[model samples]
Target: MKRSKQWDVRGAVGFAAFFHFLYSCATGCLLPFLTLYLRHLGLTAVMTGTIMAVKHLVALAWRPLSCILARRHNKRRTVITGSLVCSAAVALTLLLFPPTGNSTENKSCNISQLNNVPTTLRPRTTLQKFSPSVRYSAEHTINPIQKHNSTEYISAVPVNISTLHNNQSTAETTTSSRSDGKNSSDVQKPSAGKRSRSLMKREQKQEKITKIQYQFLESLKVMDTQQQMFFFIMMIMILWEILAAPLTWAADDGLHEYLDFVDATERHRAVKPWKLLGAAGGIGCSGILVSVLYCLIGTVLHFYAYALLMGLAVPLAALLPLYRHKREHVPGAGVKALQLVRGDSQAMLCAITAVLTGMAGSAVSDFLLWQLQDHNATELQMGIIMAVVPLCQAAFAPLNGCLSRLLKFHGRLLPLAILGLSLQCLSYSFLQTPWTILPSQVLAGISIGALWWSLEAQSADIASPGTELAVKRVFEGLYLDLGAGLGSVAGGFVVQKFGINTLFQGTAAVLGLWCVTLAMLQWRIPRQRRINYSRLLAADASEMSESESEQDNDWLEKAMEEDKGNNNWRRLD
Candidate 1:
């Protein structure tokens, strides 16, 4: 029996780790390239920003609701598996709508003619309207003439002019003869109108042909396709996010519950590092795979890779050893979570810190690729930079556990993590080359890891039994969804207006100020005034006992009498 139980534990941990690894593999494959794919589809920076912002905003509202429903129905495993399967299905659907336009043709044309156009003519609307036709006529009229000598070209021009004159005279003579009974003025008017109409028709035909050729040459067809599909894509992405938003939270919560059931709660930290390691491996490997496939096939296969990995993870998610607790519906769970946040100063501070950190992180993640591209970084270089972050995170995952323990005693890690984030943002502002940004990612991994660890620890300290999931939902909604949504929208506008550099600098300044304020508040607040779940739980327990309830009633009456005598209860802090 003991051997079988041990085997069950090993299997549970192995399956959990494998599931997380696969899930991270899918996420890493998809997210890093999603914006790039949108750009490839010919979306503008602002449009991409809006789509990303909407995705986060939807997650903010949906994550908590999904968690609540899952818990209430005791379907945590079902939710995880369903979300993974649905998200993978959606990801695979993307392959059906490949981006339009031929990049090679556009490059060839742009190099031959468009690049030779003067900068002054580039921005003129009229030039844009007429340049294609002019180029088409120039190519056709000049190419054949160039094949002959200069004498033949010069002689050919006069012959063409003489023939045009002869045709015009014949047409006039025919018109005059036909209208001999009519007045000369009336005959000339009809002839002139006919000539103008014919010329207009010819010009219209030429213009249509030129426009089509230009669109084909410049690959603007891609933009047209994107415009037509933009709304559909947005809806698909929103649905994907709605399904994906609660997955990590649900998995973590279920894992903890399982650990509690198995009397192995102490191993929670050890188990968590596996997820990080999986994430690191997934991100690094996916980056390499994408770069290799892009080079060899000149096509993106990441979406396919994402779908395969996520599909594989679904079965593992179903097999996870989640311990579902039997409980009646508790409608006040959210209310209690809110009350805990309000009562605990540390919890309130943690929430604010989460928001600020999320905002800064989103701004950097969403726009840094654009900056790198502007500096002419290649796909491989960008992949390397992205892979470095997760690798560093995985490398430092054990250190994070140790730091969480040391900082839990004094509750100093959150503020320090915020400070580290500020420094990272500041470093981003000064980036001169793509490779120059690599060092900053070390700071990024460490700070973000520490920030999340401290926030989780603090939340655990404040949450009572039965309110854990609700409390986690509140914090994650604030951090991942609300803060990130706002940051994406604002970052888009800022990058469009002042540029990405300014956006980074401004975010850094705001984070630095917030970090200082948090540190100061923590230092100034008295320990006695700070609230924790232990005090609240003790008071509730005492209230439930008859003797203690009577004693509390007597003490309350005495307090009321004192308040009546001195009005101390009404005094404002």
Candidate 2:
């Protein structure tokens, strides 16, 4: 059922929130566990790093193309289509590479194979002299027989018998001695047998060890093949991200337009666009929660369930078209959109914010799971801890928005969020237990939630009227993606070389510097130039009132024209 165009605003918001939630779910499910998954498939750290880097590189490359397409076509349609495509790619990858067996099962199976190797040895008594023929026969019996015809063996046997007879006289004294000592030899035989049995056990153990190593090598070959397939699947996912990212931002623009429409109509006087944006954070938070739930369930149950649930975003996003609207023709919209999509002070700031956020986020993502696992945290524990971040973000986002409005500090929220991020890094650097680390994620959540809301609002505030906010969003997404991608690449090397602790410390230091830089920059900007929500609300209200009055006049004129036409038609009849 299609709703009226005025109700499209609500639909647009709903679709945007749902899509954002799904995107979060997909990324959260895959990215947090990606390193572990690659390692399981026997990919070296370097290979893993390369794969991660390539994914971002592909996504970064696609941003420009996606941006152009979003600008030239239907943003909402593009978003919906991209969502479906990315979802399919995720599902295909999951199907191609089924979840690996548990570590314990692989270990136990290898051990059992080694344990089945049998002992292969016999006891030997006294150092009694042997004729050459007897020695050769004994040696031949102990060793593996060569494959040959019966005739050849028979001929050799005759020669061996002749030689034995020739040496028979020489062996006579030795034989007599052996017969005389037989009684004593029998007395000591049991002891010799005991020693030989111990030796045989040792040999069996060694043989088992060798077999295990061989099995391990064979397993390595399988792992390599699995890794290659995994790489291919990940590549497809990255390519999909490249196409999907800009489409997502385009949806952001559509929501912006819808908000503007609501304001002009004065349908919901109490609700503001920024508040709605903040509330939308819940959608993304739900995604994070869902991914975390999958992680927990995967640990306890079958992993296939997790893979399926992670991809639920696709079907949820397919409904975006129901909320879509035709592009409203605004004067100079194209040129303004292009300008905002390009470079400007606001864009640069967004890029800086995104890069710094990415760098910090990369370091955290690389190490958090590892740290938890190292501390012997169970999968369920880790999942809960991981979910805390998004949960906090979800809870705090609306609060931050309200705070921004109440305090009239539009730009200050970012600095506070940065500080929260810095605290998270510091806590990770020092915290010993994985459980203790959970509290620190609240800071991260706050940082992330506030940063997102503030950046989006700030970006919109700076753009000119009639400019599609999606263009600015595209640039924002590009820089954010670039920053995060590059951060992950560097983080891999850092974690490999210096250890996880150092990665956290380094991230904290870097974020600290960024916070300082941001503070200084904000200080230099005059108070009058800073964005005030109060002033913005006043401006929007005046503009909307003027537009509404003009619209009312036009409606009255159109009604009069229709009535006049009806009267003329009746008179003619």
Candidate 3:
């Protein structure tokens, strides 16, 4: 049955924010406690690294299995099941293996370490206190990711500063009570206990990370049929390195800058956890409140709240299209019009589309980034600029879910994407005022949001079929991951050699090419192409009665022989 556009976008914008919130929390949420977790588990650094690396390695395989499961069931069920699995993993991290040791490695003691970081607790400014400086501070660069000059790139979970600080302070008090012992000098501190605890926490956290890696792999596999998975992965590939490197590096520099600036005002900052505890037996809110006062100066820190909110929103928004499609079925003959067609060749076409589209998008984005920053940046500044990619992603990423309803290629959408990229290029090519770059950053955000979702949706349709979804999803992962790994590495090289403008131009050119390829594919396989594709399906329809007989045939045996040669290449297998 020709399904009508069963558009039931139920849920307010707030609902969309909720899911993206969880995902954002998942990113940095674990980090603050990871070392503490490692201490509890008592693992060595080598062991910890192995656990983490192994998780990524395992992720490489698990995605395919999840995709198979999804196909066997369906997209909705697969997502639900995968979500439950993710939740289970999180529970295991927090509750399943509560630190066994009651000594230095215990969870209670780790909480003590946190309590000592006074700056985090009792933040001086009111939550939601947005001042005018947040709008026009020199410290604030032009938001390269927001679609508008005013929309800053503040994506990430809202760090509950008070929650974070209080937790740490509480842990610090517990640790101090142990270290200080009521008599003040009653017993020698056991140094070995501290080392063991840190190591243990590190190991366990790493193990948990490894497991999450596998989960990501499987989700990628399971989501293959949906096509949006490719777009998601593409963003990861194109921006992970750019974002991770700069943010991580710039964070170090930015902290140093903050301390220096604070010093001029006779303001004190919180010490690293161990140092603070050594200086003071334990930090309480009363004591921490003083430190929060110092931070009242750098109020820009709180924009992270908005980032957190946006992250939570985007993923939850996705459930709308899926549920709505299920509900608004036309009466009577609608089911017959939605017949599925399946073929190995069509599956292969789907995979190719993901790779080509990803390549085009990734190349353009990275090139533009490099071109914009090449001229007057230190390596540190370059890293800071690179942070722009993820910051933008955090703000604009939610737009993808919003796009599910409009599948048809809109002429305006592509131009918007192009304009965004071109503005970024011009920012590199011309915009000298650092502040002017903010407008360009906003444009960049829009481009990323539009291109990613549109390409993913289109790719999913490359070879639509009702059967063999497992095999289809496997292809989805192969093309997507391969493109991402290649793209990130290449993007790094391009930035190193060609000046940033050349890189931007190259990326823009690739975007243009990507559109052309998609246009050609669309023209060649016009909707009537469905009727042509249906011929194989229609001819094979009678065989549906003897599905077993067809599977037992000669080609199945031939395909099995080829499977041994190259895994990603299903045709050869």
- Scored by lDDT, the top model is 1
Expressed as tens digits, the lDDT of each residue in 306-348 for candidate 3 is 2343244344434422222223323321122122212333323
- Misplaced by over 4 Å in model 3 are 1-17, 25-61, 66-357, 360-431, 438-480, 513-573
TM-score of candidate 1 relative to the true fold: 0.67
Candidate 1 residues lying further than 4 Å off, grouped into runs, are 1-7, 96-227, 327-331, 404-410, 528-573
The residue-level lDDT of candidate 2 at 193 comes to: 79
Clash count, candidate 1: 0
Write down the RMSD of all candidates, one decimal each: 15.9, 18.3, 24.9
Q: What do the candidate models score in CA lDDT, each in turn?
A: 0.69, 0.57, 0.38
Measured on C-alpha atoms, candidate 3 has an lDDT of: 0.38
Q: Candidate 3: lDDT of 188?
A: 47
lDDT of 2 at 476: 52
Worst 10 residues of 1 by lDDT: 150-159
Question: What is candidate 1's lDDT per residue for 2-66, written digit by digit as tens?
Answer: 55544366667667777776788778777876776665554556777788889999887787788
What lDDT score goes with residue 172 in model 2?
72
Per-residue accuracy of model 2 over 443-549 as CA lDDT, tens digit each: 77777877877766665665665553545544454445667677777777887788778888888888888888888887775543554677775664456777787
